[model samples]
Target: MKVTDIVDKLGLTVFSGHEGLGREVTGGYTSDLLSDVMGHAAAGSVWVTIQTHRNVTAIASLKDISAVIITCGEQPGEDTMAQSNEEGVPFLGTTLSTYELTGRLYSLIS
Candidate 1:
């Protein structure tokens, strides 16, 4: 599913990198641990995490994720947001828990 499609389907908030919502994503991974995310998230997947640190962007960049969706109503750190914008990475946020967001995203993709 396209990133924008998932956003619309799940009513997700595009906090930053709105332009990237048009991109396509084949899968989604939900995790708060940066190292776990780095190991698990696939290249073309959206990474759903509650972590607001710059390491999230680091993981996104290193993992080649389609986007980083911050769950649990959290926002990325200022530096992370700036890095995401600079790197042209899509960064979204939601009030839902990681489990809730993952289920919704999976439903949309399925």
Candidate 2:
């Protein structure tokens, strides 16, 4: 499914990177550790985390992540949003906890 599909299905807030909303989502990865995501997340996966730093966008771009979902109602910083837009990696938001969002995404994409 595309990033836009997930956004619609999960009711996610599009924080930035509108250009990437058409990107495909092959799977989902839930992690807060930067190294863990860098080492483990697959390309085309929607990453679920509470992290909102600019590094999150960098890692998302490096890993070719389809999108970043900031969980627990957290918001990405202004710089992070700008970098995400620049990277064309969709930065999303959710009011749900990480676990809940991950589970929902898994069910949708699995």
Candidate 3:
């Protein structure tokens, strides 16, 4: 599925890097541990996390993730949003919890 499709499916709102939502999303990864996320998240996957730090964007960059879904109704801070733009990573915010978001994303991206 495309990144934009996931956004629409989950009712997620784009925070930045909205233009990149047209990018392809091959899969989804749900995690909060930065190291684990970096090690396992596939390139062009949609990453669902509760993390709101700037390093989240850094790790997303390394993984080449298509988009970052900040779950549990969290919003990316200004610095995180800046880094996402710098890395061309699309950011989405939603009210869904981690597990719920994961399930929703999987149904759309799988």
Per-candidate total of colliding backbone pairs: 0, 0, 0
Give the CA lDDT, 0 to 100, for residue 37 in model 3.
88
lDDT of 1 at 94: 88
Predicted structure 2: lDDT? 0.94
TM-score of each: 0.92, 0.98, 0.94
| Clash pairs, model 1 backbone | none
Better of 1 and 3 by TM-score: 3
Candidate 2 per-residue lDDT, tens place, 1-110, comes to 99999999999999999999999999988999999999999998999999999999999998999999999999999999999989999999999999999989989998
Q: Name model 2 segments beyond 4 Å from true.
A: none
Task: Report the CA-based lDDT of candidate 3 relative to the real structure.
Answer: 0.86
lDDT by residue (1-109, candidate 1, tens digit) is: 7888878878788877666777889888887777787777789899988887777777787888889888889888789888888777789988998988898888887
lDDT digits (tens) for residues 1-110 of candidate 3: 78887777778899988768889989888888989887888898888899999998888888888999998889999998988888889999998899888887776655
Among these predicted structures, which one has the highest lDDT? 2
Against the true structure, candidate 3 reaches a TM-score of 0.94
Better of 1 and 2 by TM-score: 2
